[model samples]
Target chain A: MMCGDEYRESLRRLKPEVYYLGEKIESVADHPAFIPHVNSVALTYDLARAPEFEELLTTKSHLTGEKINFFTHVHHSCHDLVRKVKSLRALGQQTGSCFARCVGHDALNAIYSVTYDLGKKNGTEYHQRLVNLLKEVQAKDLFLSGAMTDPKGDRSLSPSQQKDPDQHVHIVARKQDGIVVRGAKAHITGAVNAHGHLVMPTTSLKEADQDFAVCCYVPIDTPGVIHIFGRQTNDDRKCSGCLIDQGNPEYGIVGGEALIVFEDVFVPWEHVFMCGEYDFAFDLVERFATAHRQNYGGCKTGLADVLTGATYALAEVQGTVGASHVRDKLVEMVHLAETLYCCSIACSCQGYALPAGNFMADPLLANVTKLNVTRHVYELARLAQDIAGGMLATMPSESDWKNTSVGKYVDKYLKGVADVPAETRMRLLRLIEGMTCGTALVESMHGAGSPQAQKIMLMRRANWEHKKRLAQKLSGTGESRHD
Target chain B: MPGQKRRVSLKYCGSCNPLIDLSRIGQVLPAAISQETDLLFVSAEETNIDTIIILCGCPRACGNKETIRARALRCIVVAGESVDAVPVAEKDISTAIIKKLKPK
Candidate 1:
C-alpha cells in the first residue's frame, strides 16, 4: 500500500529516458503535461492504501500473505473479475480518464494462466518464474505498464515478412545468459512514468515468427530503452496558464501514451516469461484481450456517466431540460450507456477459472462487449454533443474571454439562460469538445482492439453450425447436426 | 493539376454525415482532390443527394454497386462522391452502384 504523494515521489527518483515535444524530459512527475496523468495513476496506489477500499483495491498474495495492490494480484475466482471491474469503474469515476494500470494487470493474469499451462505441458518453469516476479511486484508495490502493440509497418505482411524486421519486437540476439530484444511499442499508455514494463507480443505467431514471440519485463530505465511521449488533442493546454481549456483539469484526456523503444534491452532468463513459445502466444493474447475488453465496459461507461451528467447539466443551464426531445435524447444516452454496463457485468458473470485457479472472462462475450462499446460510445458522444448544442464547437477560447476589451462583450453575449456565467458555459462546452470529438473517441474505437477485430472474434466463436443443424432437424433432415 | 477548379459539393448522410468534421475533410481531401473545390456542403442528410458527392449514412446502406458507381463518376472531373466511410474490400452491392454512377 502506498500514498498518492509517495507514489508520485517514487517515480521522480527513476531516470527514465523520456522525450516530449522533440526534447528530453528530465522530470516526468513534475511536468504540467504529465502531472495530471501521473496523478490519475497515483490514485491506484492511494486507493489500495485506503481502509475502505482495501478489499476491492488490494488482495492478499497467495505466494506470500502480504497484501498487494489489486492491479498486481492474479484473479483467484469470478469474484476477482467482478472486483476488478468495480475497482476500475471506481477509478474511472474518480479520475475521469484512463489510470493506465489495467494493461499490466491483465497481462500479468494472462501470462500467469498461459505460462502455467505451458509449463505443465513442456516441463518449463515459466509459471514459477512469473509467480516470483509477481511476488516482487507485490512486495514493492510497483507500477507495471504492459507494452503490447508493435510498430507493425505493413498491415498486409506478417512480422517475418515485414521489410523492416525490427518493426515488430523480436529477439535480435540470444546468449546463454539471456536474450536481447530490439523494437518499439507504439501508443503504450503511461510508459514514461511506469516503474517497469511487461512487454508481450501483439498477436498469435507461427514458427516463422519465433524470433518475434517474446515476452519479458524490464525496468523503465533499462539501458538502451527510450520513451517518446505521444501528443494528445489540446495537450498544449495542460501547460497553458488557464484551466478553462483543460477539460477535467485535474485529470487530462487520458493517460499519456508514449513510444517505448527497446534497443538491445537484455532480460535475464528468470525475467523472460515466454521465449519462442509461439503456440502459447494466442493464449496470452486472448486472455489479455478478454480482460482488457471487460475493462472498457467499466472505465468507458464511467466516463460516459460523467459525460452524461455534464451534458444533462448543460441542458439544464440552457433551459432545455424541459424539452421532450432533449429528455428523450438524454434517456437514449442513458439506455446505451447502461447497456454497455450490462455487457461488462455479463462478461464478468460468465467468467470461468483458468488452470492457474484465476477467473477469466468469457472470450465471446468480452469481445461482444467491446464491439458494442465501439458503436454505442460514439452514439453517446453524439447525443452529448447534440444536447450540448452547436455552442460546444463554436465556444470561444478562454483567452478570448480573458481579453480586456472584448471580455465584457463575450460575458454579455455568451451567457446562458439564467444564473450560469458565460465562462461556465464555455468551460462546459470545451469539456464536451475535448471528450466527444478528439482523442477520447479514438481511444474508445481502438483502445481495446477496433470494432472489426472484435467482430472477427465473434464470427469465429459464434455457433452458426449448431443453428443451421437445428433448422435442418426441423426441416426433416434426420437430425444430422451434432453439438 | 487542372487550373479549372471543379466544384464538388459533398454532403454526408447518416452517421457518416455527422462524423464528417471540417478538420477531417481538410486532412483527407488535399491528398485526394487535386483540383480546387467550392461549396463543399458536408451536412448530415436523411436522404441521398443527386450531386456527385453523396456520402451514404452507413456502410451497410451503400453496398457494392453504389461504391462502383462513385468510382465511375471519377471520370467526370467535375463532381464525385468520395465514399471514405466504405471499407475498400467490401464486394457487396455498393460496388455496382458506384460503377453505375460514374461521371460521364
Candidate 2:
C-alpha cells in the first residue's frame, strides 16, 4: 500500500484542472489551500501502513483476496462494516478533520450492491462493469471523490422540469461505444485532489427525468472536467502565514469541497454503471446515504475526542479545570459524542447482507446516527465555546503574538495560570475556534445530507402501522371502527 | 489423570463504546476457567487454541468475524450481557463463559 508521501507524489503526477480564489491552481499537491486536505487524505494512506493502524485501516479485498486499504474494500460482513466505522474514527482522531475518502468509499459499496440487483432484474452487465472498476480501484489504491449533488438550478422543480437542463448531469447522447454527459456537481468533497470521481444521480428520477439518471466514472484530469474549490471559514488564514491562527493547519476543517462542471464529458460504456435505469435511482441514493450516514458518529466522535482534549487542556491552562461547571460541561460533551458513537456502532452491528452478498448498515439506525450528529455536534461545539469563554472568539492573531514590541504585552496580558506559556492557551483556543466555528459547524449539519434528509429517511423507515397497532392493543382499542 | 488443559485464546473488538466492563471480565476469566475445566487462557496469536472467546462491549460483537473465529476450533462470543447470544448478567459473564468451555 502507498504511504502518505507516495499518495502526495501520486497527486503531483496528475494535473487536474482546479481553480481556487478566482485563480487557476497550477498544482493541487503543492498549493497551500489544498495541502491540508491533501495531508488529510494522505493520512488515510499512511495509517494503512502503520503497524498500529494496519489492522484497522487495511483489509483483504473481497474480490481479489489481496491486501487492500479498508477504504476500497467492499464490506463482506458486519465485521467489515464495524471496522469501517472504527477506521473512520481512527482517522478523525489523527486529523481532527474530514479525510475526504469515505465519500467515494460509500459510493463504491452502494453501487456494488445496487448494480448487482439491477443486473439481475434488468439483464444488464452493470455489475460486472462495476467489479472491473472496483478491481482497478483496489489495485491502484486510488482516491475517488463521490460526485452526487448537482447544481440543481431550481429547488422546486425536478431535473427534467428545471429551466436549465444542464443543472443536473444528464445523458445528452448515447453512442455505441460511450455516452456524453453535461451539467455540474456542486460541493463535491475531495474533488480537487482525487484521482477520479464516481458520479451518481443526486435524487430519485421519474421516466421524464430518465436523461438525468446517470452514473459513471470520470478521471479528475479528464477532458472537459473542471473543478472550482469552495471557500471555508477562515480559509484565508492558511495563506496568512500564521500557524497558530489557522487551527489544525496540517489538516484544515472539513473535507476540501469543489464544484465540478462536466462539460459534455464522455464516458466509455465500461465506466458507466447506470444510465436510463430511472427506477434504481432511489435505491442508489438511499444506499449511498445509508453508507455515508453511518460514518458521522464514528469520525465525529474521534473529532470530539480531539476537541474535548483541547478543551480540557485549555481549562487546565486557564486554571478552570477545578471548576465544577467546567467539569460538568466536559462530561456533557463526552455524553453527546458517545451517544452518537453508540448509534453508529448499533447500526453497524445490526447491518444485514444486501442481495449481492455485501453488507449495508441498518438504514433506519444509520439515518438516526447522522440526524443526531446534526444536533449533538453543534451542542458539543457550543459547550466547548461556552467553557472556552469570550477569549476563544477574541484571541489575538498569531502575528500579534510574534510582534517584537507588542508580543511581550500581548503574551503577558493573555497568560492564564502560572508557569504555562501564554502561547499554549492561545494555540488551544485557535484549535477550538477552527473546529467550532463557521465551516466546521456547517459541515456537521449538512455534510452527508442535511438534517431534513435524514428525517425523511427516518419517517419512511419507521413502521407507523406496527407502532399504531401496539398502541391500539395496549389501550384496548384494537377493535377499531373500520375493523 | 486429567486430560491436557484446553488452550483458550482471547480477543477483543475496538472498544468505541462498550456497555460492559471488558477489563474486569478479562481479569476474572482466568481464575474462573481453571476451576470448572482444564482451560488455560492465552493470547490470540498462540497456536493450538481449542476455543476463542471474543469480548465485544455491545451486542455488535464486532470481533466475532469469520477471520477471528477461524483462529480456533470453537468460538464463544460475549456481547455486553450476552454469551453466545444468550442473556447473562454482567456479573456472571465469566462464569457463563466457563460453563461453555466445560467438557460434557
Candidate 3:
C-alpha cells in the first residue's frame, strides 16, 4: 500500500492544469479548498496499510497474487462484492462524507469484466492489456478517478447528432503507437487529486458513433489535460477558519468534482483498454452503474446515520429529546436510513459473477437501491433540518460568536438549554445546515444516477408481462383463463 | 360530564401544513375535536379558506361561518397570507383561540 507521504509527493510531481475559483491551482495537495478531499483520498491509501483492516481494504491481486489495495483488486468472488460494500461503509462512517475513491473501485471491476468479454468475442487482447494495467496499479496502489459522463450538449441529441462534435469525448486520431482522444468529462469526482484517470464511454453508441466509444487510462498531469473544479455550495467555508461551518471539516463534500478536458491527449496502446468497441460500450456502462449504485446504499446510508445522530443530538440539546413526537420522528428517520442500508446489503447479497469472473451487483436491485436513494436521502435530510429547526439556518457565524463584544451576548441568548453551551448548538446547527442545504444533498440526488435514470432501468428490467399474465390467471379476466 | 368518556378521530392528509402546531396538537389533543365537536372550525390559508367557508356553509350542517372565519384568519396570519381586515374583537378572539388551542 502507498504511504501518505508518498501519495502527497506523487500529487506534487503531477503538473495538473487545475483551476479553483477561476485561478490555477499550483499545488492541489496543499490548497485549502482541495486539502480536505485530498486527505480523504489519502485515507484510502492509509487504511490499506492498517493491520486490522487488511482483509477488507486489501486484497490479493488476481494477476500477481500479491496483496494490493482493494481499490486496485479485481472482484474474484461474491465475498469481494460484500467486502467492497462493507469497506466503503466503514470509510463513509469515518469520513462522514464522500471519500471519492469508490468510483475508481467500481470502474475497475466493471472494465475488468467487460474488457474480458470483449476480447473473448472480438479476439482482442484488451483483457490481457487490462490485466497488465491492473498489476501496475496494484504495485503502485494508485488513486484513480473514474472519468465518465461526457459533456452531453443536448439532452435529446446523441453523440453524433450533437451540434458540437466534441461535446462527447471521442478518439480524435489513431496513431501507429497509440490513440489520441479529445473532449471533456464533466463532474469527474477526485479528478484533481487522483494520480490517474480511467476514462470510459458515457453511454451506448451506434455504428455511426464509433469514435465516441472509447475507453483508456491517462495520468492526470498528462500534457493537454486541463481540470476546472466545479464549485460546491458553501465551498468558501474551506477558507474559513471555523471547523463547524465546514461540516465534516476533515472531508469535503462528494469528492470535489471537476471538469476534465482532454485536448488531444495521447494514450499508449497498452493503456487504451477499449478503442472503438461500440458493441461492448453499453455493457461496460451498465456494469459500472451497477457497481456504483451498490455503493450508494453503503456510503450514503452511513452518511444518513451521521445525519440522524447529529439530529438526535440537536434535539437533546434543545430539550426536546424526551418528547414522544421527537422520538417518533427520529424513529422514522432511522427507519428510512436503515431501509437504504438494507437495499445496499440486499443488492450485495444478491450479487453474481460476471462471465469474466468478476462479481457484479444484481442490476435490477442495484438500480432500485439507487432509485430509492434519490428520494429518501433528500427526505432524510429534510427531516434532519426539521428536527434541527430554523436555528440551523439562522445561527451566527463562528467568527462573530468568538468576537469579544458580541461573544457574551451570543452566548447568553443563543444557549439552547442551560447545560449545553451556545457554541455547541451553533456548531451542531452549522453542521446540519452544511450537510442538508449544501452540495452534500445535491450530490446525493445527482450522483451515481438521477432518479429518472434508475426508473428507466427499473422499467426495462421489470417483468411486467409476467405479472400481467399472473393477474389474468388468478382473476379469470382473460379469454383463455381457466378458473 | 365528569363520568362521560368521549372518543374522537381527526384525519389530516395533504401536502402542506399552515398550522405550525397541527402536528403537536394531533399528538397532544384529545379525540373530541373529531367526534364531539358540534361546531367544526375549518382552519386554512386564505387561498383555500374562502372555498372551505363556501363548502361548509352549503354542504355541511355542523360548520359555523364565524368559527371557520376565525380559524381561517388564524391560519392566514400563520401562513403569511392576505385576508380582509379583522375586527378588533375578531383579532383578539382568534389570537386567544390560537393561544389556547395551539399553545407554543
Q: Enumerate the candidates' DockQ scores in order.
A: 0.01, 0.09, 0.01
* Tens digit per residue, CA lDDT, model 1, B24-73: 44334433443324223222222232334444323333222353235322
Writing each residue's lDDT as its tens digit, candidate 1 over A207-261 gives: 9999999999899998989999999988899999778888778888877899999
Name the runs in model 1 displaced over 4 angstroms. A477-483, B1-104
Compared with the true structure, what per-residue lDDT tens digits does model 3 show for residues A114-157?
98899889988888888888888889888889998998999798
**Relative to the unseen true structure, what is the C-alpha lDDT of residue A181 in candidate 1, on a scale of 0 to 100?**
97
Q: Which candidate is the best by DockQ?
A: 2
- By lDDT, the better pick of 1 and 3 is 1
DockQ of 3: 0.01
Off by over 4 Å in 2: B1-104
What is the per-residue lDDT of model 2 for residues A354-463, given as tens digits with 9 covering 90 to 100? 99999999999999999999999999999999999999988888888899989998899899998999999999999999999999999999999999999999999999
Model 2 clashing residue pairs (backbone): none
Could you tell me the TM-score of chain B in model 2? 0.91
Compared with the true structure, what per-residue lDDT tens digits does model 2 show for residues B1-104?
A: 36888889777765544678876887787667766557787878788888988888889776778988999999999998999999999999988888788876
**Cα error, candidate 2, residue A329 (Å):** 0.6
lDDT for model 1, please: 0.78
